[model samples]
Target: MELLDLLLHPVRLRIVNAMFGGRIRTTTDLCRRLPDVPKTTVYRHVGLLADAGILEVADERRVHGAVERHYRLSRERARIDAEAAASMTLDDHRHGFAAAMAALLAEFNGYLDREGADPTADMVSYRQFPIWLDAQEQAEAVAALTPLLRGLAEKKPRPGRRQLLLSTILFPMGEVEEGE
Candidate 1:
């Protein structure tokens, strides 16, 4: 399957997101974390991801006479490169974006459903900002954000640290109508 096709599915997308931060996770860990997803479904999709090289087996061990594998996202393969992005049709972009949004919504809903959840204490945030920028400014803005994002992504999990989802969508809204 195409990289985008494999990464864009709701289940697979969630799996990839779950494995972000370079953390290795076993099928059992995934099943427990994503209780809404059936165990069989998680196993099936995980196998497909591993077969496609999107996920790599980080470790394996024998558990109850069966081989249990721990996997981590292959960051390089998990992304849609510029070449692949350029080749995608408008329909593909639409479907992929919709699937991503749906996954984000599901995650947010799950967060809300958890007991003892405190959006304020947890630092949950959902906000939008309007900005005016020309092409050069836009490029500069992206350059500025890239390193900060990269640093955050590379930080290893530590004691007393919690994982936070960081979703960003940046696109031109459209040409300003007449004078707005």
Candidate 2:
């Protein structure tokens, strides 16, 4: 099964994003963090992810009469291969992008909803531009950006350091010209 397809759901994506800080969380913790999601719905998606091998069962314990299981990302970062994505229809791309955008917007709304969301404590920004680049430069740009992402994916924060989310989206600015 394509984990990408499974993660396309906003709830699971949000849960995965919530776990990014080298932190593991149980169902209850997820419920608290994802107040907009019904607890049962969260559990159903979490179970699906675990079954898909995208989420690992990190820890477990009994909470009252029930067992609580904590979960963490099975892979440090999400990846999809060309072959996997090649078969998707235009509708799939449209729906997937819309889902991702909605998830992003929800996170921004979450920050705003945080207690004591001080301007000094938060900021968000984005940039876009039309540009020209040769194939080599385009490849180089992706190469240059990969390490920063790998660092975010692999770096385990120390006790004193706060966890941070480093999200980036990059692609060629249109088809590359042989000479530009």
Against the reference, the lDDT scores of all candidates come to 0.89, 0.74
Position 11, candidate 1: lDDT = 83
lDDT of 1 at 71: 95
Off by over 4 Å in 2: 76-78, 171-180
**What tens-digit string does per-residue lDDT give for candidate 2 at 37-113?**
78999889888888887778888888898888888877633445676579778887777777777777777677678
Cα RMSD of predicted structure 2: 3.0
Candidate 1: worst-modelled 10 consecutive residues by lDDT? 171-180
Query: In each prediction, how many residue pairs overlap at the backbone (N, C-alpha, C within less than 3 A)?
Result: 0, 0
What is the TM-score (0 to 1) of candidate 1? 0.94
